[model samples]
Target: MLADIRSRLGGVAGINFGIGGPIAHRIDHLLSGARAGIAIKFSGENLRTLRDLAEEAQTRIAGIPGVTDVAVESQSEVPELGVHLDRERLARNGVSFAEAGLTLRAALYGAPVSRVYEGRNAYDLVLRVQEVAPDSIAMLERLPLRTDTGALAPLSAVATVTRESGPNIISRDQVQRKIFVTCNPAGRDVASVLADIRDAIDPLLEGKVGYAVHYGGQFESAAAASRRLLASGLLILLVIFGLLCMTFRNARDATFVMASLPLALIGGVAAVFLSGGVLSIASIIGFISVFGVAARNGIMLINHIRHLQSEEGVAGFEEAVWRGSVERVVPVLMTALTTGLALVPLVIAHDAPGNEIQSPMAVVIIGGLLSATVLNMVVVPALYLRFGRPVKNNGGAAGTPGETFL
Candidate 1:
């Protein structure tokens, strides 16, 4: 069936996780993280006697989302183990089907036969062989069979044992039989898609199947980490913006400096995605670095624009803009080159923890700085030339039109 399914689907990369017996039981933690495929379990009056519920569970679990495959390890062919019971060995020891059946019943059957009265409370006495003592196949082989001569004989002399390699159990948290019903999203976020899958299954989970379900994986981790990174960045950005306001002593200039962040972020995010990387913790931290770097470049450009307006006797927009951009070009390039070069070690280092922290950050900073530097050198200066028309000669160099207008 798996071969047929694969054939029907056309060629695609896949990882097979199912193994017969109780192996699925150990996969609960791992399953929580599955982005694709299904985990399964089987339980019924028929399965009540076997160690292999995993195949049954998988059959049912295949119905869950993101589950493309529904293969059962237990159900997969093991033809030799499929041979009928050896009745010839049974007859040799006078172990006819009826007698052997009775022996099996006595070995496995349990019932609350009677209650014993003591003082005040009566407790029911349930009869069952202690499982660990004698119910196992090994113990059963050593069981004494009564011969026609009334002699006790070992049952092992009658029947040979063949270990059945099949499903053992499918359990969740040490109880209940269960399989994973995975949800695989085409393009949606793993977290959002998993949530949608769970929501869809809410009304669908009939507990009548006698199993449990769960969700987990990369999406879960990403959602958690994204929340943390967002909060941290917001706090840091606010703090940095506040410091800029304090240092500049002018809210207008500080606002212009802050605009550099948007200038930097566009290129940084584009580069990150182009590199085939997600916005992981490393990437977000890199993004935070962009803010500081962009702000620094903005400050430099603004300072030069002020100088061009004041000392250079720059009259109107274009002259101040051109002079500001040209004069600040060498300094901004030096600053960016120095910082970018310093981070080269992090980009090349593979195993260092410090390298992990710095690599994405350096990449983001490098990309954002390159962008913002160009913008600061070109657009910012042009804007300064256009808008920073200072009415001077008496008091002081005038601020830009936007600040006065605001």
Candidate 2:
């Protein structure tokens, strides 16, 4: 759709499109506040120099692959008429500078002289000299000004009018004038496009004084959010590990359960790779949830093995392991099957509306469930049997003679 729209707008300048849904647009607005594309801000003391630098940067960025809608954000040369008042000429005409300025203003822009009352409502009566047109410089030059001596003089005798251009609006950051050279990424990611822009512009800014460049908008927001999410993910892992330790009351069992986390990762990462190779926030969240589920399955299996020995008086360690795993296989498979089946639709309709976040999450979860379920049932039990301590029954030591492995 965006490509079709861009083609339809052929030859039209200063217009561009950004692809985003309502929820994504709102989230982006909250993150960057009206900045729709990647923005490179150039700041300096001189407005002309800043504008020039921005244009140069825009030109450099436009040549990079996958960059589109390259343009300067500020209007640096807006046309206007400039009026310069001559103090000496006003004095020679016996006219005060203030009076001459007021007369010229009154002629160009009407002055309120009186008010008319109608039905308790009053309207200001304005007075001004009539002209051929509102913006006619010839008419303005012939406008009359009254001096203190009651003499009339043409406004041109005391003022000079010229056509010129200047900035329509001057934007400032940290008290320095700033201009933004912005562009959108078309076929590539923002980070890759920005890397190319930096390489292109670095030489242009070298040895330049009183000027600096800063990246803003989506690039800035994504970098910040990535850092925060990384920290949060590490914190989540630590919290999960602590809870597992508290549950089993032994470091060995907790460490054994954490092995399932890597099993989940094997499938989750593979799923994301198969689905466009994009690792978004939703996929990371799915990984986190999968880790918890994997740990829960390990906990359930290990607890059952201990229960068979301590409570049910199973004689041999191998017998207890076999019986416990056989008993718990149904529950573990049921959990994985139910969750994976529920997410199958989301994985299939990955490009549907409102499923942008959910689809990637479902894909990761489903993949992780497959790997974690198979490995947790086999690997986790093996690790416990090899390295785990023997469980003691209410009567005495549980395992048969010569059968205790640890």
Predicted model with the maximum TM-score: 2
The prediction achieving the highest lDDT against the true structure is 2
Native RMSD of candidate 1 (Å): 12.9
lDDT (CA) for every model shown? 0.57, 0.80
Number of clashes recorded per candidate:
24, 0
> Candidate 1 residues 1-406, lDDT tens each?
5446545653553444332224433443365533243322222333333234443444443454544444433223232221123577766766666655544445555457799999999998867533423325677666565656666555566666455654454343455444443323332334444554555444443654543445555455566788988998888778877876665445655666677788888878876766555465777777777777777888888776666665567776466666777777888889888888887677667356446456767677778777877776766555544544443322354433333422
lDDT of 2 at 250: 64
lDDT of 2 at 357: 83
TM match of model 2 to true structure: 0.73
Q: Estimate each model's TM-score.
A: 0.51, 0.73
* All models, RMSD in angstroms: 12.9, 5.6
